[model samples]
Target: MKNCPNCNAEIEDNFELCWNCNYSLTEQKIIDIKDLNENKKEIDCLRCHVLMLYSGEYKFHEGPKIGVLGNIFEAFVNRESFDLYMCPKCGKVEFFAPLQNSEYKFE
Candidate 1:
């Protein structure tokens, strides 16, 4: 196990990025993922009532087959990506749809 330089969080040896603070060990710095939209909405933590920090973009990938209803389920719930936000104090995480391109078409 290794320690993250930024947040001092314990990290696995094989992992290059710090999960707690999003610090890149290889790059030796924190990864700042910014939103492309100029008028980005600031999210507040429901529990803490403090402004949430933008973590990064998270993408969902299809996993193994889920029996006969896998295709049908994927068709109905076809979300691909989302913007992740985290509360600095309470470690609360929230997911929001991409602000730049709100429309998503499954193809």
Candidate 2:
């Protein structure tokens, strides 16, 4: 905690404004993950005509996973990052994009 310049009150480092005094904190950036998620565009499947699912984020691993006895596993694991909306009828998967690009989007 640091002393507020205006009132000399102790303020947490993570906070933008001091609790005791309305002191402006500089050199801090506030990122809103919810706003970014809400603004992301959506895409739909053309064949299924239903909204696709948002598969999670994926990363490539260089080495294979070894079992207890040193058994090598070839296949990689699927990592889900974001929310996915899959088609109930066809089970098509899609990522968030733009409404114009997607076949299904809320008007």
Q: Write the per-residue lDDT of candidate 2 for residues 1-107, one digit (tens) a residue.
A: 67777677777676554444345466233323233245444445577554333344433445546766333444544432334544433555554433444443667
Residue 47 shift from truth in candidate 2, angstroms: 1.5
Prediction 1 TM-score vs. true: 0.47
Stretches of candidate 2 exceeding 4 Å from the true structure: 1-37, 55-62, 69-85, 95-107
- Cα displacement (angstroms), candidate 1, residue 29, comes to 13
Which lDDT value does model 2 have at 37? 42
lDDT of each: 0.70, 0.47
Clashes of 2: 6
In model 2, how large is the Cα lDDT of residue 44? 52
Error of 1 at 87 (Å): 0.2
Model 1: pairs clashing at backbone N, Cα or C within 3 Å:
none
Question: Against the true structure, what is each candidate's TM-score?
Answer: 0.47, 0.29
